[model samples]
Target: MTPRADPLTVDVVDLIGTVVVRFHEEYEHAAAEHSLTGAQARLLSLLAVEPLPMRRLAQRLKCEPSNVTGIVDRLESRGLVERRPDPDDRRVKLAAPTAEGARTAERLRASLDFAREPLGQLTVAERTLLKQLLQRMLGITPEPSQNPEQEEKKGGKGEKKREQGE
Candidate 1:
């Protein structure tokens, strides 16, 4: 049988901590280049893909909706983002990036050199494995995959616990 890994050590914890800290530092630096806070840049990045409800953004950012509102308000004033009614649910508003916001987000992403270089060196499969491992480490289950090999990699539970809010 394969031997189980030992429990996490302080050194390992510190290494992960350092990685998180450095990643944020890099992100914050990129955000500052665009005159945006890291949080604003993050929300803009998400919107660049697709508009999301404030509640959803708040959940993803692990912050209060009021905080998201304030950020969105500033972005809106700058003509970077616009609040639109969700067609599926009129009661909810979706925060979408304006054309300028999309470009800004793209630029901010491109400027994150620290992440870009190392991640670029990895193959697509290696990147996917890294993502899945990170998700599990952070208690965020990786999404269920169609490939049988991937399903086997899930090992259990992760596939069933896909819903973030739940």
Candidate 2:
């Protein structure tokens, strides 16, 4: 019989941590020419993809909504973002990237391709295998989690709801 790999021998968490650090380092360098902070670049990119409510954006960014307001304000001052009234609820504001903001995000992304070159060294087959293996081991592809607004929309069980009398 073939020898079994020891489950305890694998340090997958450390490997993932290293990968994230390296990726961010490369990203910081790539976007340096744009003079945008990492957070700014990330926020711009998010808004470019789709307009999101302030609360939702804050949640996605893992920060307080008030903090998101400041970010949005800065971006707006730079003419990179614009806010509009939500269709369903005028009281709610939706944030979207302007054309200039989209362009900035695209430029940042193009520059960031330098970070992918190392991955290109792997053969297509190896890359595919690695991706599949990692996915299988993790049971999910890593990505950002839902924002508080999204949780609210999902009817968060733990969230308090106002009673009619209260």
TM-score of each: 0.75, 0.69
RMSD (Å) of each candidate, 1 decimal: 10.2, 16.3
**Model 1 Cα lDDT, one tens digit per residue, 10-99:** 678787888889999999999999999999999999999999999999999999999999999999999999999999999989999999
User: How many residue pairs clash in model 2?
Assistant: 0
Candidate 2 TM-score over all chains jointly: 0.69
Per-residue CA lDDT of candidate 2, range 1-166, in tens?
9786566645666667888898888777765678777777778888888999988888888889888899889889999999999989999889999999999988888787644676555544444467667777879764454344454456433333322223
Model 1 regions more than 4 Å off? 1-8, 121-126, 139-166
Count clashing residue pairs in model 1. Answer: 0
Model 2 sits at a Cα RMSD from the real structure of 16.3
Q: Which residue pairs does candidate 2 place in steric collision?
A: none
Candidate 1 clashing pairs? none
